[model samples]
Target chain A: LDATAVADAEARQAGLVKPAGALGVLESLSIQLAGIARTCPPAVPGAPAVAVFAGDHGVLAQGVTPWPKDITAVMVEVFRNGGAAINVLSRACGASVTVVDIAVDGDVAEGVGTGAEVLSRKVRRGTADLAKGAAMTRDEALAGLAVGIEIANRLVDGGADLLLTGDMGIGNTTPSAALIAAFTGTDADLVTGRGTGIDDETLNRKTEIVAAAVARTAGVDDAINLLAEVGGLEHAGIAGLVLGGAARGVPVLLDGVIAGSAALVAQRLAPASIDYCIAGHRSVESGHIVALQQLGLRPLVDLDLRLGEGTGAALSVPLVQAAARVLNEMATLESVMAGPDA
Target chain B: LDATAVADAEARQAGLVKPAGALGVLESLSIQLAGIARTCPPAVPGAPAVAVFAGDHGVLAQGVTPWPKDITAVMVEVFRNGGAAINVLSRACGASVTVVDIAVDGDVAEGVGTGAEVLSRKVRRGTADLAKGAAMTRDEALAGLAVGIEIANRLVDGGADLLLTGDMGIGNTTPSAALIAAFTGTDADLVTGRGTGIDDETLNRKTEIVAAAVARTAGVDDAINLLAEVGGLEHAGIAGLVLGGAARGVPVLLDGVIAGSAALVAQRLAPASIDYCIAGHRSVESGHIVALQQLGLRPLVDLDLRLGEGTGAALSVPLVQAAARVLNEMATLESVMAGPDA
Candidate 1:
């Protein structure tokens, strides 16, 4: 973002009809939007879309989450049919959703097969159980990230001015925690949260598995290598989405902990890539807060939400749009005031 | 409100193809809307509007806010010409703006005369300076409240699903702070804030004036008496608007400190009236948060805003409508789920 453009936008905002900065964060948001667009009034983010990355976490075999792995494929099917939460929310937000089966346990061609209903980008059925060994090879991680980058390019090229990150994999939050703790060097138990509301025993085991994964995954020099060791395919994909968005200078709205973890790695890959990211909402997960703090980003909405799949991200679309609109549309102070600035 | 309707909404929300409470405050907001509409799936709130109460504060002469009292009339003219901040934002939110001249110092009939340009509801020229004597007689306050109630009745009867509270008054934040501190027994410095970015000297004087007014206004016992003592005519009107919204079961989104202070008085007038109230944003004014806390209402949006005239409230109309749409249109978990609880 150009500093002079941001400064110009801020000066313009102060001159708007209302008391200076009375619109609050909306004013700041508009200024940022202006800076990003490099104009006093940038184009409103048009044709927003949420891309949900689906993949199974092999850690589910460790009794990490009570959900059946089959639930993952079924939920993807639900998203495909527009019967899922993200589907409903995206509609409410006036946005579209695309479900990408990068590493789901099911076959897409035999399942909800193609023509935008589902993108068949499966790198593998699933990764090995991380509690037993390395989750996936570094090459597999690179492939998943590449898949995400390709999808990001496709979505933006297809006319999505705003991209939202969504995730659909049971027990994915476990790896999200693992990734966060590994990158931030935070404690496992402190950062771990119950994925899909698991009971005491499951949560304890999930935390233990996360700790072991972090211990095994520590000292990975590259962000992608860390993803290969302890992160889910969706994490690599979302990280790639951030990279692509930054590379294209498009804004990406991040969902909860999963997206936050990916953002941490994306920040490492390209330090300035975090600039394109906006934390959509704060989730109930402890690690989510840690990730946001480390990134120095504030979530627009704090709804105590734990559901993933870009539901939180989709909800904030109106806010972001309003920010731009307020800047673009409101009458300036000079236009309204009769005399000089004294 | 119907308890059964709220229960039904909550149950439906839980099964709305998302994790239980994943939508967070939106889920709860939907349930509340359902209860207000007295149905399981309430009607989507459509066509919102802001009725901005324009008045002048006698506190202007006491050296509180720096802006001239004439600015109120000038801004009202701006609103009439549809060139004000409120007008621009209301249009952006897909809502109309109605400027009601309840106690503006200027003559509306002569100034912004004729047509539906401005609603003539002026109770008097303006209230008396608060630091010296009572702002208005009890009867005048009742009359102002009555005007607000009639306006509210007209709005909802005329097909506005949501009515937002707006105000146009230069130096009104002083009375707002006085009203809040009077009602809540908060200290002067604790509740007073620099309205419109006043200098330190003015803020200190404003704080002292607020303290004196609260002392004089103490033991009024009745809500109307408190209004008569230190409240602006717009304050009484906004309180009446809250009462009117409650009587009609219409949701009223409140602006910044002025609306917050008015809501404090409204909640006192009718304890259950606060149910119809929603705080739009947290203002920079310390009194706004104090009032929200006193009323036990959480603001939907918190941006450090001090501008009045329903700007914050109008920005939140999009959010309010989205919440309703989510409840009415989202698919149920049973519709998407493959099998049973397992």
Candidate 2:
């Protein structure tokens, strides 16, 4: 069952009364589901879960962003304390967000207690400084993938039909771009953007560094090899989660450039993994467009958003739900005895 | 005791949080309440009643819009039936919207099946074609204002602490621009803008017509006189609602261009009415900016929005609540005892 067939069957469901094309993109989404499930009226009982992957990059030591590196921990504290933007948006969207300390150096228990669930799977207290050394070893990359798969399986077993992947890593975009360039066969210039609003001089330097990193591992074919050479642990984890969603047939909403690049790596690992992926929105990051186009994904909203705390995805969740509701709820023209012109 | 003091107290309370300026514009809003209520702790109770006034203008018969005049009634049906954008946004914001049919030449009871409580006080089937005659007589304008005040009083009695004024009148922007020009001493050409996506040629004609109407009513002292000469009944009603909110110390969120012009009229009627008014967002209309500036009211959101179904105000409702919540909920620096740098 391909994407087109999935869309068609979802639209042809008896309970959905509107004409097949009435709701535009929403109708197409309904049909896409039918083709995927190989059943009319694809059930989308949403058990929404957001995975907030927290990590640190050694690259932060090089003064890429103006904010202190500790602000990341402070923000993680804020997230834990339910004061962050993601917490507000998640609350508005009615999704429970779990903060996963994938590579933040301390015990998750030591931090300000997040009101939500906390998952601690620290992979070596963060990646090696990507500028000087590989971010992680191939073995560590595989471990990250295993962790992501485990999380996804847990969410599904807990009755989550939809997964939202978010990341909170200072200076992770450099590694994210490197991974995107490696996977998409695009050069660093096209796949690198100003992360955290760097100056022109720093942007040029960052682009050159990512290009050098991508060039070092041009022949890497395996997902584990790619992850070991140029991926943050959180990136690897999210990629694995995307693949996990595909295996379980649950929809995954990707947040920001980091999650987008991770999805690209996941698609390379499992080509059919694209079926479960939905681009939430294009971030202000220049690389996000390149990665989204590579994956053939279209965003639901575009508000010149650059904030990466999954706020854009959370705002877009309503639109996605609206699309599904329109497919399932709108009265058909035939039922209303109204002509298309009416 | 007064609106400005209330706004000021709210702002001071908001500023005393753990981080003095963390919430951005929301901080200013808390202060706005201090000024409005003339007190230290401004009351922000949730008595959210949205008044969606529906009407039609005889000017619409001039084919100024590509959409038919009947769309005015159909869209009222859409709003009543919960299919319009306002319905979606109001539902998201948890505000109940009441549809008031004012001077629209249609069966007022036809679309009342939707859950919206319909208030029909027809000033007339519609306003006179502004191109050839005054929109309404002085008696009719006063009658509209009375109807609006009556509705506001009823809403207040029913426990509404906030009034949201929205309009659904087709081709009413001409009258709105004329009213603004009459009140603001601005030339109609500068204040008039393309309404409902009109073409450049139609816009020019609309602008000329509005300028003439403004010229005809230059020396009006009372807002009711100006409204009678140039405003639609819905416009007069909204103006009266703004005054009612001010007199009763409830805040009113003004929607789009027509609502902005109405607020301007309300300001002229009661200069202190500015205390009760909060510009929801700057609509794409050129006159709205002038009206907002003249009234010294700053808008919360600026999305270049022109969809005038109270969607902008509804979107800002959460922001307003957030502003009030920050004032009321966030821990103070003394309480948290954290670094003042926070």
Which sections of candidate 2 miss by over 4 Å?
Answer: A1-47, A66-78, A81-85, A110-114, A173-231, A242-257, A260-307, A315-342, B1-47, B66-89, B107-114, B142-146, B173-230, B246-251, B254-307, B315-342
lDDT by residue for model 2 (B1-342), tens: 355666555555544422334334555666675555556555654667888888889887666666566667766666666655566556656678788888887887734545367778788988998878788899998888887787788788888877888888878788888888888899888889877678898888888888887878766688878888888988988987888887777788888788888888888878888777887767778998888888887776555557676756765675565455445544443433374255
* lDDT at position A165, candidate 1: 95
- Per residue, candidate 1 scores C-alpha lDDT tens digits across B83-183 of 66677677767787777899999887533422125789999998999899999999999999999999899889889888899998988888899999999
Q: Pick by DockQ: which candidate is best?
A: 1
Docking class of 1: medium
Q: How much lDDT does candidate 1 score?
A: 0.83
Clashing pairs in 1: A15-A333, B15-B333
**How accurate locally is residue A179 in candidate 2, as Cα lDDT from 0 to 100?**
85
Whole-model lDDT, model 2: 0.73
Top candidate when judged by TM-score against the true structure: 1
